[model samples]
Target: MKPIEITDIDVSYGAKKILEAITFHADAGEILGIVGPNGSGKTTLLKAMTRIVARDNGEIRLDDRDLDSLGHRELARRVAVVPQDISIGFDYSVRDVVMMGRHPYIGRFASETARDVEICDHAMHLANVAALAGASVHDISGGERQRVLIARALAQEPTILLLDEATSNLDVSHQVEILNIIRDLAGEITVVSVFHDLNLAAYYCDRLLLLKDRKVYAAGAPGAVLTRENIREIFGMEMLVKPHPLTGKPYVLPVYMHQSSAGANRRVHVVCGGGTGSDILHLLHAAGFTVTCGVLNVLDTDYGTAMHLGLPCVAEPPFHGITPESLSGLRKCLESADAVIVTAMPIGKGNLDNLRVLLDYPAKPVLFYARDHSTRMEDCTGGEAGAVLANLEARGALRVEGAEELLARLSRDGSDRD
Candidate 1:
């Protein structure tokens, strides 16, 4: 059975309408996530579905029953909501907070029974906040308080759980813990959670509902909903989406704006590490300059980032030790480039001579970022190759400090060619 259903729902706050005919359904034993940017009405939608916010149009049903017809007691027994903004105004104990979820079941003006205490205890344990049961709720951390709230919701014994940015304040490990708990509970109860973290949503949710500007932008499995186009359109940023290696889930990598080559008939060879050179390649391309790179290990973050960006790269197998063949190939790749920029990367024995090869082609201009000579020299195979740089600089190797400077120089070079 569909656990919760919304049909043509429209919600407004005072004079302003927030939701635009939002329609979706959550099935029994399934996990779904609602995601969007700030002020996108994710929380508003949850509130409307839970009857916390009045809906002006459309209908909502819980397990085939009209939601509006349910009384406060009946509604609380059927659906529970954990809001995004969790703030405590009173100094209630953790157990006191959780015990409140039993309000619908208790008789009017009656004290808690033994069963209520047992359920509250189990709920606290389930949320992993049992140790804080006696402590004041307001004194706990955000993550801990969030857990307490979830425990309170669980204590409601509802079949449908609606969570709004439930793990926003949790650390990495706690985030995983809370998500795992929700995932484990999906089979017995229906879950519809709001998540701002795209990676976390993609990893945990069986389906995704993307809301943009208070309307449904997309809805489907993560593979379909979290595409490059959807992300760029909704988030207003360019991103590359790839399947995670271990989980086969979609992962987003933001694409920073880059420059293009303008007038350069010349190409520049960039020795980069840690994906830092990817932007430089784009800049050169924008200025109409060609770029090439080499001796990077295939698994290196920079190498992969470059490869995905479609840069001409000569990459070696990771950690296999750069061999004569790899070095030769690297040199060949840079043969046509007019200049070379050595990015800040640790120089190690395995790939030490990668920089040394530049000395053979002294005719090409070399540029390095203005940095401490001692550190740069140390990375050049224990300073054995540092003298080459010193001699070249003494002769004339330009040092550039910023992207604009490099682009300006390339622009001048381009103008000269014209």
Candidate 2:
């Protein structure tokens, strides 16, 4: 397969520019993913490469040959695109639809040769649509139809395949199956797919190009392109980008606003560590509380969540015990907060100071998620942390059994203050 080079490409609808000074190249035998929010020209860019959308300026070249120089048939022989939407008004068998890809190879009046049939068969098998070959294209499910369309593209024998949000309508399982097939095909054919699922793109694509505001926002490996800051800038949404546990690829989890308005003017300070604080922090922020969290280690999961939400956090170095400076910072946060909540995380010497400081701030309304006291004390420092927690409870700290109850209590308290 040949590499695709797009240089200084500009596309405009009349006087309105859709893409400006766009430049990128998809390497041979690699999957290059294009991602951006709606109206960012992801589909427009794919259409430009296939000449479905004419570029007002710049050049698109496959290998060294210019796209404009190639005839329609010649371009179809080299580049095949699976459009975002496919409609079959007339009833056509899946096999018949797939055979259409051979038009470039077979002359206008010529019949399909044995080799053409074999190529179409192989394409169907590769796309896992061989069993559905006799079915009507309109009778099958959307996922099945999608595979059939991909089979048709494969049968085109193109050096480059362009997928314009092909998996957008697929369910999770179907999405995985389709993307896996594309990933495998990348070993031999160049693939350029536009994706809405950032996690899937990060996992499958060899490289990614993020488009924003009519230009390339960031382009590189997933780790370099899918940062929290980049998503916030391009999508105007809060997201947490972390490593996938199984693949070690970038995983994106969107932070949604669960509540529409601020429930109260009260501030809440949360004491948490390990990964325990993530849910509490999210709920507090979504509930419209001015939330602060501390003293999380710099690399902890909770710290990442806190940073993603733009919450002020007191952080210490990773793998280090909490220092006096961090404790002092926590105390200041407690002083300003109307209430404090702690998640159920195992307590160790490194963070036992969290419990100690909460005990000192007895005047503030303190809540402890003590759903499983034994589990929380499993890592207690010689039971010292457990004893401190017990002392805090005795000093009027409220204990909640679960997140639902905690949120309920918080909502009730916010209403009471109002």
- The lDDT for every candidate, in the order shown, is 0.81, 0.88
lDDT of 1 by residue, 68-149 (tens): 8999899998888777547788899999999999999998989899999999999899889999999998788887888888
TM-score of 2: 0.87
Residue 1 lDDT in candidate 1: 57
Name the runs in model 1 displaced over 4 angstroms.
244-248, 256-267, 271-303, 307-338, 342-363, 368-418
Q: What is the lDDT of residue 315 in candidate 1?
A: 79
Q: Give the TM-score of each candidate.
A: 0.75, 0.87
Candidate 1 lowest-lDDT run of ten? 369-378
| Clash count per candidate | 15, 0
Name the TM-score of candidate 1: 0.75
State the lDDT at 38 in candidate 2.
92
